[model samples]
Target: MTAAIRCVLFDFDGVLADYDRDVRIGHLAHFLGRPSHAVRAAIYASGVEDAADAGLLDADAYLEALGRELDCTVPADAWVDARRAATHEKPPMLSLASKLRARGITVAMLSNNGLLMAQSWPAIVPALFPLFSGRAFCSAQLGAAKPSPAAYLRCLEALAMPPPATLFVDDNPANVAGARAAGLVGHCFAGITELQRALEEHGLA
Candidate 1:
């Protein structure tokens, strides 16, 4: 039998790329030449989480806040480049995306990425960005980040697919739970192998 799901939506950071939050903090600390704790506190004080969760901050504001905290002038593009350097490729998941597309399943990316990151995605992962035929959704544009029903709903509405007919994948438990609450079949992504197993179990592989 064919897979029950017609579309698959993915979260970018932890799912598509191995982005270590600690590493990021370290990088920020190094750039600022300050203690990690100080950098982290400044990040929290800058309302980074709230802005990200609300999807209201663009790349400029995001980077500017970090720059302000660090007492440096890190441009948005520079920050994007730094993140790209730290990110490790997840080829297996990319292969899975290709397989899904081959099966005539619609694949889309829903990422809570900064505007600069979104703009630079094509350069970072050429294969992944254009693979979906330009159906990638960035939170900076959508104004709603993951773990929010609004984000998932917007993605579903954009894809013109029902929640039941869609599969949502994310490494964050909260994001997975949010997708479930929004009525989509959600999977907490551990790795490509585990994800493939889950998809097979769900009869979507």
Candidate 2:
């Protein structure tokens, strides 16, 4: 008999929550009182490549750095708060996770998130947190980020599941490739509908 898929690991930002890229840019621009393009460039140059991806920079720090780059004074907290308000939970994905659990497949989340944001996430979306019967594998705590085999390995170790029996889903193609290299079946997530179909085809859902 073939070994069954016992676990599914999900990426957080674009997979669980529609990452508000436009809102983030707008917030930085408003804080700096500069054009969005200029603020966006400054944000990229702030030694923080993709704040959400690295999970190192919080909204406040991200806005503050952008403001300083533009020589403007803006309250970082306000900018952060506004951006937070703009975030929306992906209900369909959460429903899919519930279905997976009903079928006895363990579900987990892996994210390249910082300590502060990870800590605050449960409050924003309580349902998402509990869907992971296995705890979340956050990069900041693990000391490694995605697209690095070490991160995926750490998650596998934590889940106590072998990579071949675990399915990894991520929005980034590079991350998906890394998971495959690490021995997990990987999927580049487009949306929940496609993901549900993939899971069904793989006998995971």
Candidate 3:
């Protein structure tokens, strides 16, 4: 709500890039030679994922733990690739980030992802940093995730910016509300055009 916004944090999966979780699940299931439901259930039930995201587990250990939980072994790279398969580029928003960055606006990404995503980011969306300039703030690395006020607040704290000086955009309404709760301006992303309109509405465009 303030005109003094200095940073724009975008959510990766649904904002800058599109991904289908079901596709990732399908790929994991196929790679493991198991049913999709079983794999999905294992992933959710094992609860190793959040630990990995929180940086409590390394990629290798995370994958190994997941395999053990599911009763199947999968190479770490293969598992990363399976997750990568779900992503599709959303270039327009990326270009917009570049544009905003060129204007001296700090553009960055924030996502509720775990360790593997941080390691697999380069392949997931090639040349992401070129557009963003700022570092990718993965929730796993932050020790907090979106939909939690701590997540947004951690980003602001790390960046050394006050909440009023940051704008957070995410596809999830809960995340948007979390940003607001953290004292940053929150924008719910629908599409490129909608986000552009939001920027203008907030006098950031």
Tens digit of per-residue lDDT, candidate 1, span 27-98: 767765778787677666667645744667666777777777777776655555556666775888888988
Write candidate 3's Cα lDDT for 66-130 as tens digits: 88877878787777788789888787887788888878888878888887887778777775855
As a TM-score, model 1 comes out at 0.84
Candidate RMSDs in order: 2.8, 3.5, 1.8
TM-score for all models, in order of appearance: 0.84, 0.77, 0.92
Can you tell me which runs of candidate 1 are displaced by over 4 Å?
1-3, 28-38
Q: By how many angstroms RMSD does model 3 differ from the true structure?
A: 1.8
In the range 1-205, model 2's lDDT, one tens digit per residue, is: 4456888899988897777767877875775568887766765666554553465566556445555677786564555554466567788888887888888888889887655455556654566766763477677656678889988998789878899998899999999999999999899999877888888888865
Task: List residue ranges in candidate 2 displaced over 4 A.
Answer: 28-42, 49-83
Report the number of backbone clashes for model 2: 0
- The lDDT for every candidate, in the order shown, is 0.77, 0.75, 0.82
Cα error, candidate 2, residue 163 (Å)? 0.9
User: Sorted by lDDT, highest first, which candidate order results?
Assistant: 3, 1, 2
